[model samples]
Target: MPDPILPLQADQIGKTYRQGATTIHALRHVSLTVEQGEFVAVMGASGSGKSTLLHAIAGLIDVDAGRVVIAGQDLSLLTDRALTKFRRSRLGIVFQSHNLLPSLSAEDNIRLPAESTENLDQEIDDLLDRLRLSARRNHKPAALSGGEQQRVAIARALICNPAILLADEPTGSLDSVTGAEVCRHLRELVDDQQRSIVMVTHEPHVAMWADRVVVLKDGNNLAEFVTDGRRDPQSLAKEYHQTLEGEVVR
Candidate 1:
């Protein structure tokens, strides 16, 4: 049998911020591992360290303790410049805000990341078409709907052909119908492209899209709920809510 591969891994990670005498612990000994081609969701309430954990794993912030590895490279050993190159080449990030440039068209937005590549055009229209944004390729961020803008962001992230994609509250700003649409698009990308995703979200509906769900609270990973196959989101949401309620009672 072939050795299993992991795109991202975190071990005993912790982060703390000192505001005068009051020290706030943002992530508390959180540990997570994402295998290759797996879509895993990290779910938590506000201030439950979901974003903090994402930042730590993405190497956007320094952790006071523990270590992180991305694409088999030990992040702790890399210098700042090397780390930046490593991240730019292997990790993709999508935010809730869509973060598209106002002046760039949707196709241009998706191709921006490819500029850093060595003689690679990466066919913007093909990507746009796959994302169902081909018709909207000429539109700018201001011209597109919220769901359309997020799809552009996803196309941009995937344009790099990165080893892993990190998404934080990707559907937090969208309406219910639009959010579901975005989720379907994400599923297509992951299933067809063999892309691994580590997503942070509060919505159980969003979390259910993942192959496995990791529950986080008080700065640590608590549990995992996985389905036998691809389970229905509606049923998964009911169980997730019940699991959350039980946690509250304990």
Candidate 2:
């Protein structure tokens, strides 16, 4: 048999931004691979280029060097229109903000990206139920609580049935309790549904939910460690700091 296609493959990706006379490198020779049904978290400080890498994988920004291949298709080989269509079909993205339309109800927001109506109702109902928002389906975003709104956003992201889900600081706006709840739901998706996910977060508490964590610093992948299904937040936090400070941690 041929080699299995991964959910995500980013190879030697480089990104640079030019501001007049200054050029800032956001990513330098960065590479990441996420297997099917794996949950990976990318952790970094504000300027560490973690977000840039995520966006590059989502095809929101072009990388100056290297290639991003999702499933088996290379993003660099697609035209702009093809990229947009492919992204909509193959990638699910969730940001820090819920980004739901205030006027639309929860179910409607989830239905926005849907391309076909065949079994659409059943699919939307299933998503709402899976996210535990079945009761809030008719409610608009303004009426939902922070966690609820975020769940709706997640439901929206999954509506497309994409190959990979990319989340950026998914819990940044919620309280600790609510954040933990969202993280639990994410873990459930991986364990129960075999979803492929790549989450970017700065908090160890959130990163601890993933199967493995990749730490980034100064636009490069600093270190990576497996949670091994048992690493606690406190210990992971310590390991994260040690990795950031250029210390070895096993």
Candidate 3:
């Protein structure tokens, strides 16, 4: 039997931009694959192309070369309308900003992405319970804490039962303790629900929550290391910097 289609496959994707007389290669033949139920974090310094790669994988921007396939469907093959619909159905995106409406309650915010509200009451309730927001379901964004607001964003993303969840600095705005809470919730989503996630973060503690870390440098995939049994953030930081410095990590 043939192998099953992967959740995400970004094949040698490249992107470039021209700044007046200078040419900038934002991404250069960078490839990444995310399997089912895997949590992968991409780390890099400024201008390292990690954000570019995330945008490419999210189908938010078209790559200059290569192709991005999500759940067996090629993004380049879809028209604008079809791509929008496909993205809404198959991809969940969370950003540093919670992006929740200040006037809407937590429950209503999560309901915004549902194509059909038929039989959604239980699902929303389940998500609220799962995210430990059952008591705050009726609270508006202004009434919620930062971590709570971000969790609301996460629930909204999951409302569509997306094939993959793409997060860009999901905990960037919260305090350290609150950020760790959010990360733990994300980790639970992967461990308990078998969700596939790809996140971009510069913090070692944030990246450590992922099952694997992919480091990018100078628009190239520099190295990657599994986080399993790697409990020390200082060690991970050392390895990450070493990788960025063009040194091999044992």
TM-score, per-candidate, Cα-based? 0.91, 0.98, 0.97
lDDT by residue (tens digit), candidate 3, 218-247 = 888888988885657898898888888879
Runs of candidate 3 with Cα error greater than 4 angstroms are: none
lDDT of 1 by residue, 1-250 (tens): 9766689889999999989999988888888888877888898889889999988778888899999988888889989998887787788999999999999998888878774655345466668888899899888899999999999999898887788999999999999899989988887777887889999999877887898888777776766787445547777776666666665332
Model 1 worst lDDT run, 10 consecutive residues: 115-124
Query: 1 or 2: which has the higher lDDT?
Result: 2
Best lDDT among the predictions, by candidate number: 2
lDDT of each: 0.84, 0.93, 0.93
Ranked by lDDT, top first: 2, 3, 1
Clashing residue pairs in candidate 1 (N, C-alpha, C atoms within 3 angstroms): none
Give the clashing residue pairs of candidate 2, or none.
Answer: none
Q: After superposition, how far is residue 17 of candidate 3 from its true place, in Å?
A: 0.9
Report how far off residue 31 is in candidate 2 (Å). Answer: 0.3
Model with the higher lDDT, candidate 1 or 3: 3
Q: Rank by TM-score, descending? A: 2, 3, 1
